[model samples]
Target: MADDPSDQDGALSRRRLLASSAAAGGAVWLLRGLVRPGSAHAAPGAPPGLPAGLDVYQRAYENWAGEIRTDELWTCAPRTPQEVLDVVNWAYGAGWTVRAQGRRHGWAPLTVADGTPAATRVILLDTTAYLTAMTVDGQAADGSATVRVQTGASLESLLAFAGAGGYGVTAAPAPGDLSVGGALAVGAHGTAVPAVGETPSPGHGYGSLSNLVTELTAVVWDGGAGRYVLRTVGRAEPDCDALLTHLGRSLVTEAVLRVGADVNLRCRSYLDVPAAELFAAPGAPAGTRTLAGFVDGTGRAEAIWFAFTDKPWLKTWAVTPDRPLAARAVSGPYNYPFSDSLPEPVARLAGDLVSGAWASAPLFGQVQYLLAKVALTGDITDVLLSGTLVQDVLTGDVLTHLLLDGLRSDLWGASRNLLEYVRPTTLRETANGYAVLVRRADLQWVVSRFADFYRTLLAQYAARSEYPVNGQVEIRVTGLEDPSVCGVPGARPPLLSALRPRPDRPDVDTAVWIDILSLPATPALPRFYRDVEQFLLGLDGERATVRVEWSKGWAYTDTAAWSDQDVLTGAIPDSHRAGGGPGWDEAVAVLGRLDPHHVLSSPFLDALLS
Candidate 1:
C-alpha cells in the first residue's frame, strides 16, 4: 500500500485547511506546553550537614502523566557514589528522608508523593546529572557478557552501549528515556515468551529486567559504623532478591547485568484484525488469528485497542537474523512517527475533549483508529470514506504527509530499535497496570474474559453519557522469572517482581500484562478503573493470580487511584503472599533491615509495604 502521487495537490490543500483549523483549536499550543521543561533554581539555604561541593537546588517534581506534582523541593546532584553515601548518612542522622530522582518518567509515587511541600524533610537525589557511567565488563566462556552500569544511566544509553559491544537484553521497556535505577526498582518489563519449539539464548530472559542483575551496590545502614554505608551484594545472597525490586525502599547506585549476544528483530503491525476474533475464547476453532496464535508464532506481540474501537493495532516482533523482503530496514529506535509526535488532528481532538466536549468521545475513538490504520498500512481508503467528522479532522493533506514521511508497517533492525518505540514526546496518559499469571494454555481465556468485561463496562458508561477513557488498552504477554537465566548459582527470582513464579502453581509460567490508559483528569475514570480492578482481582478464580504493576497506577477507589486502603494494604500484598516462598513479607523485612532509619522510604511506600 504505497502512496499515489496523482492525489498530492488536492491532499496538500486539504491538509493546509485542517492544519489551520487545528491551530485555531490550540493544538500546537497544547503540544508545546506539554513538552516544555521545568526550570530549577538555587535554594537560599542548603540543608544542614550537606556534604561540601554537592550541587543542591530547589526543583519542582512532576511525574510522566502530570497526575502527580510537587512544589519546589530540595534536590541535589551527587557527583560520585561516595557523595551519594555521604548524603544518605546526613539524611539518616538529621531526621530527613532521601529519594532518588531519575528522569521522573514513572506514574506511581514511589519517589515522592504528590503535593509534597518544600518544607518537607525530603531531598531528591538527581542521578542523571553525574552518575551515568557505564562500561563493558569482561565476557564469560559461554558468549554471555556482563556490563557494570551506574543506576543514573538512561535505558537508551545502556542499550546503545551494550548493543555496540555486541550484547543486548532480550526485552526492555518501550521508553528508552527511563533511568536504569527506576526501571529496575519497579521491575519494569517488556513483552516476550518462548516461541513454539524455541529455546532461549544464553543470558537472555523474558521476564522483568530485574531478573538480569547479577550484582548490585546499595546504600544501607551500618550498625558497626554508626551510619549509612555502601554495601555490594551478589545475586546468590538472599538479601539481593529483595534489593532486585525494592520499590524505592532502597537505593542502588550500580549493578552488573547479564547480556547475551545481540539479535536482529522484525516488527510488523496489523490493523485488520477485529477485537472479537483476536481476543476470542480459548476454545475457539483452530487456525483463528487469535492473540495466542500470534504468540505461538513470534513470541513477542502487543495489542493496542483504542477505546470503543473494534479493530485494534497489533504489533508482533520476531527474531530475524536476516531481513525479510517485505520489511523496511531501520538503524534506530522510536520508528512510529505518527505516535511519537501527536498529529494536529489528534491534538485538536484531545484539546476539545479536555475543554468539556464530552459528547465527542465516539468521534475521538474513531479518529484514533483511522489514524493508526492509515499510518501503519498506508491505506487512506477508510479515512476518505469516513463520515464528515473523521474526514474533516484527518484531512487528505495530513494523511499524504504521513505516507510520504517513511512510516512503515513492517520494520527490521537491531533488538533495541524494535523493542524501544515509545518516545518522550508521545501523549502522556495515566494508566492502571496489572500482571495476570496463568498457565500458558489459559492465556486466551484470561484475555477473552477481560476483553468482554471491558467492552461491556465502556458501553455502560457511554450509555450514561460518561466518557472516562481517552487512551488505548494495551495487552502483552511474557514469561515468569527464571533465576537460572542470571547465570548465578543459587540466584533467586526478585522477591517483589510481578513475574515471580508461584511455588504452589508451577504451571503458571506466563504473565499477561493488561493496562488501561486515559487522560489524567478524565471524569469518572477512577470509578471505571475501580470496577475493572475488582473484576480482575477475582478473575480466573484460584487457577490464576493478578499482581499490580509497580510503575503504574493501582489500588483504586471510586474517586482516585492508589487510594483504596483494602487494596493497598490487603489485596496487593496478598497477591504476592499467595502460593509464596519468601515473597512480599520477606522483601519488606529485608528492605526494612537495610534502611532501619527509613531514610530511603516515602509515606506511600511505608503504607503500601506495611
Candidate 2:
C-alpha cells in the first residue's frame, strides 16, 4: 500500500482545515505503531576504559543520579554483536544480568536496575566502539535502493551518506547526536507537518525515518531454547510485527532499509497566533492538521501549549516549498549556554567545543555530550539550550487548563519546553513504545513576560477545576509506519519503506528516571493514572489500542488496568500481551531452537522461560 502523495488528497480544504478534529496523519498510521532511543553501553574486557570494573564505590559514584544506576555495569567498549552475545552468555553462567547501553545521557533510571534479581547481576555491554558502518547499495538482496547500517551508526552519518547518494531519510529525530540504535530505542521524532494530501499523526513506534529498515538481525535467548540468531519469516510471524516495538529480549545487531531520492527541505518557524484564532482556525487539514497562525502567505499552523507560567502558548511553524533546510550556522554551540548559571568549568568547555570545527569528542566525559547537545538539532537536549525549567505539576484537570491558559497569557509567550520519556505506553509492556512527552514548565518564567496573567490563571483554574493534572499535560500524538507495509516498485514517495528501524529498550523492566519521579509514597497516583488509563482505553478501537509513554511509575495497578487484554489485543496480540502467548514456554522453546545449552539465558530470561 503505497500512501497517497499529494497535498490535495489532504484531509481538508483551506477554510475548513482549522479546528478539524480529524487527526490528519492518523489514518495511515492506523496501519502501524511507533516509540522510539539514547545512552550507549560498554562491554567488559575489550578495552579497559575509564570507570572500569564494578568496584562498589565506583559503580555508585559513576551514576551520580543514584536511582538510575546500579552495580551491574561493565565498562569495555564492545565493537561487535558477538562481543554483546559473549557478554550475555558469560553473564548467564556467571549469574550476572546484562543490558545494552548507549550515551548514558538519560536523567532517570530508565536504564537503571529495579528490585529484580537480575539487577544484582547486571552488566553494561557498551556499543560506543562498535562497528559504525553505513552503506548504500544500488539494489537490495531482492533489488531495491537499500541503505545498510550497523547498529552503531550515527544519524548524521546516515544523512550525510544518503545526501551524497542523492537520497534522504523521509524524517529523523530532531537532533543528530544520538546513535542510530539509541534514537530508535526511545521513539525520537521531529514535528513533521504532513504533506498536502497526507495526514498529521502522532509519534509512536515508527515515524518518517523509521520506514527505512526492512530487516533486523539480532541475538535472542529463550533460556530453554538457549541462544540462537533467529531469522523471522517476514510475513509469517505476528510476534515479529509486535516485537518490532521492542527488540524482543534480544540485542539488535544490524539492519537494512530503503531511502528516497535526495531533495531540498523548506522549513519556516515563527510564532504569535491569538487563542480564539487558534481554536477558530479551520479544522485540522481535512483528516490531518489545520494552519493556526497566519491568515495569508503564513498559514495558521501548529502551536505548543506549555504547562504552568502565565504565558500558556508558544511556538508556531509553517513550511514553504523549495526553501530547503537552512545551512547550519558554521559555528554556534560555542557561543554560549544562554545563561550564566552553567558551571564555569562546563561553560568554558561548551563554548570552546562549539567555537571550533567540532570534529572530535571532548576530553572531559560529560562535556562532549553537553556540547554535542548545543551543536545538534533540537531533540531530547533542546531544554538545556532553550533554558527550559523543569517542575512538578500536581495532578488536576482544572490546573491543567489553567496552566495552559497562563502559558499563553502570562508566562512564556513564544518559547516552548519538551519532555522525553523512553518507557512503554503502559507499564505491562514497559519495554514497548517510547513517548517524547512535551510541555512547558516553570511558572517562575512569568517573571519575564506574562507574570500577572500567569498568577491569575493558576489561581483561577486551581479554584474552579478539580486541581491540575500532573503539573504537566502530556498532550499526545502518534506517527505509525507499518513495518508490514512497504512501497511497490517504481514508487518514490517522501516516506520510503526502508526507514522503519526496529526499537530497542536496554533498561530494567522499570527504572526510576530522575529525582522528580521519587514522589512521596502515598495515594500512589491511582486516581490520576486512572483518568489517564480511562482516556487511553477510551481511545481503543476495534483494530488498535492507545499506549502511554514512560508509564512505569504511574502505579502498577493503574498500568495493569490500562493494559488489559481486551484493551491491548487490538494493538498487540493476546499471545504476546504479558504472561500470555505460548507464555514463557514458547519463548523457551524458540530459545532452545536458537540456543540449545541455554548459553544466552540470564535470570531475566529465566523469569519468562522457567
Best by lDDT: 1
Cα RMSD (angstroms) for every candidate in the order listed: 7.2, 17.7
Q: Estimate each model's TM-score.
A: 0.94, 0.51
Off by over 4 Å in 2: 1-67, 105-111, 114-119, 139-144, 185-189, 198-210, 221-243, 274-303, 309-321, 324-478, 484-534, 538-544, 550-610
Per-residue C-alpha lDDT of model 1 across residues 73-147, encoded as one tens digit per residue: 888899999999999988988999999999988889999988888789999999999999998877988888999
Residue 500 in model 1: lDDT: 96
lDDT of each: 0.87, 0.33
